[model samples]
Structures are given as structure tokens and as C-alpha cells.
Target: MHIEKNTFSLIEIPKIIDEKGRGNLSVIEKDGVPFDIKRVYYLYDVPSDAYRGGHAHKEQLELLIALSGSFEVVLDNGFEKKKVMLNKPNIGLLIPTGVWRELENFSSGSVCLVLASDVFNENDYIRNYSDFKLFVGA
Candidate 1:
């Protein structure tokens, strides 16, 4: 790995729970992430055996949150790999630029919310693993 695997980690979103009859609420405001938020999207109805995210961004930063159900995210920083299980609605996996990622093992009705640092741009993506290694100069 040209980049350090430890660069990625989970972030807790602040929330408020009602002591009365209401449920809990989470908030991600303007200073919530490391970069400015430019886009937001979610994945749902994914087959349990299916996978997503087989690319790395050269300049985009992302945060993956499990809004419902659960899934596993594998992060690779050219030289090392780390597996993280995201099950909680209030926790997110923060991914920096130049790191490869793969998402799989999704539970039933799983929802994946992704917050990105920029709009969709095809030029920023490194889609193939072999090319990714070469991009990172590994």
C-alpha cells in the first residue's frame, strides 16, 4: 500500500435521543466532515451476494454511513487492507483520497448513504485494481 491503511476510520455522528415518547435523531452539520460536502446518495435493494465500490478516487473524499441494516467495507491503501462492519445508523466510515474500497456482505434491506466531497466526475476515479496499483505507484 502506498498510503497508510490507518488513514481511514469511523466517525460518530452526533445525535439527540428523546426521553419522552419520541425516537432518536442524528445530525451532520456544516463542520461534520473533513471536506466540503458536494453530493449525497444512497444505495438500497442490493442483493445480499452483490458488491459495490470497486474503485478509488484520486481527489474525492467520501463518508459511508449505514442508515439501515448492515454491510462490510473493505479499504485498501495500496499496501494494506482493513475490513470494517457498518451496522449503526450513527456511525460512518471516512475514506480519504487515493484509497481503494469495496463494499459487500449487505444484510436485508440495507441502506448505504454516501457523502462525497465533490460532484460525480469520471476523471477522478481509478476503476481497475491493477490500474489502481499502478496509479499509486505500487
Candidate 2:
């Protein structure tokens, strides 16, 4: 997996609508998401002023989706920075490894669902900005 450090993309999942409202499903084995699903988690009931994800992963890849409400994701590759707004249930943001990410501006009652490529490993995280910059040779 030779992923570019600045390579982040939005993937659209198919939504089904019928007489009984609407719903969507995301399958990791399908092209809807790029990695093999290993871990799944979600964040909800966040304060309007609260923020999450202030670090970069060394090898873990993730897909972040706004299941409800809205939020902003700020990504930095140690050289370039980008901001993306996630406000749809059927849309996801692919976060590759070696990129710094921050999630903020979350609406009240927002739910952030994350699909991870690897299991939990504390050693794979770069929790400090200074350390991340040095690691990426910024």
C-alpha cells in the first residue's frame, strides 16, 4: 500500500429509498471503502464545542463518516493542509496513514462512525504535533 501522504478522498455510499424512509449501507469488501475492516467505533453525543482526533497514525487507515448531523475534518500532510465537511450519512472520508487529522465543529447530537483497517494499537499513533512533523520530515 503505497499511499500518498496527502491522498484523502470522499467516497459515496449507495442510499436506498422506498416507502419507508431511507437507509444506506457500507461494505468494506466493496469499493465503497478501500480497506479491510478490522475495527469499528463511533462517537456521539459530543458537545457543540468539542473536538476529536488530533493525531496521525503510522500504519492504520480509517474511513470516517458522519452518520448524523455534521462536522469538519482538518487534515495536514506536514506540508499541505485541507479541510472537509462531512454532513451526510452516505458519504465517507478516507484517511490514509501518515496524515495528521483533526475533527471539529461537530453539531449537537452528531454521530461519527469510523471504520479502521487495523485493530487498536497505541504504538502506531503519533499523538504529538512536534513528533509527527519530525517523523514526516516536515
Candidate 3:
């Protein structure tokens, strides 16, 4: 999965609003998501100044959505960096392989939902910043 620096993007999912409330759903079909879903996880009860995810994947794709509250995701592709805010339940940020990401500035009661393309594998992770930079040829 040779991803370029511009591979990451934000996708807006459809939200159904009605008289009672609002609802949204996400699918991992071929046309819906870039890859098939293999894992799902969520993060909640994070302190206001807490942070998470400071690594890059060797071959995995992820979609991050803020189910409630808000948070910020900082992405680095060795050559360039980008920061994105996740505050909408119906929107998600697509992070491809080879990009280092860090979740920070989480608002209280924030719930972050993550859809992954692969199952858990410790060997697939590049946790060190220097190593990640070398892997991405920075």
C-alpha cells in the first residue's frame, strides 16, 4: 500500500434528520469505504488534556469519526503534516497506511469511533517517530 502524502481525506456520510431526532450510518462495502472492515473500536472517557495514537501502520486503513463531543487528529506523512478536527457524527477522516497519527485536544465526554481494515497485529505497527520517518523515507 504505497500511499502518497495526499492520500488522506475527509468523507461525509449521509445523515437522516427527522422530527424526533437525527441518525447516521456507515457501511464498508466496496463503494462505501476504501477497504473491507476487519476491526472496530471506540475511545471514550478521555481526559481533556489526554492524547492517543502516536504511530503509523504498515498496511492498514482507518476511518475515524467522533460519535460525540470533539477531538483533533494530527497526521504526519514524513514530508508533510495535517491537523483535522472531528466533531460531527456523520463525518469521518480516512487515514491510509504509512501516516503517523496522534489524537489530542479531546473534549470531555468525547467518543471516538474507529473503523479499521485489518485486525490487531503488533508487528504491523511503527511506534517510534524516528523509525516511522525512516520507513516513509523522510
Best by lDDT: 1
lDDT of 3 at 97: 88
Q: With candidate 1 superimposed using the best TM-score fit, by how many Å does residue 116's alpha carbon deviate from the native?
A: 0.3
Instruction: Check candidate 1 and list the clashing pairs.
Output: 1-78, 1-79
The C-alpha TM-scores of every prediction are 0.94, 0.90, 0.89
lDDT of 3 by residue, 30-83 (tens): 666667889999999998888999999988889999999999999999998899
Q: After superposition, how far is residue 75 of candidate 2 from its true place, in Å?
A: 0.5
Q: In terms of TM-score, how similar is model 1 to the real structure? A: 0.94
lDDT per residue for candidate 2 within 1-138, as digits (tens), equals 345665898888877665565554544445666778889999998888888999999999999999999999999999989999999988899999889999999998899999999999999999999999998899
Return the top candidate by TM-score: 1
TM-score preference between candidates 1 and 3, better one: 1
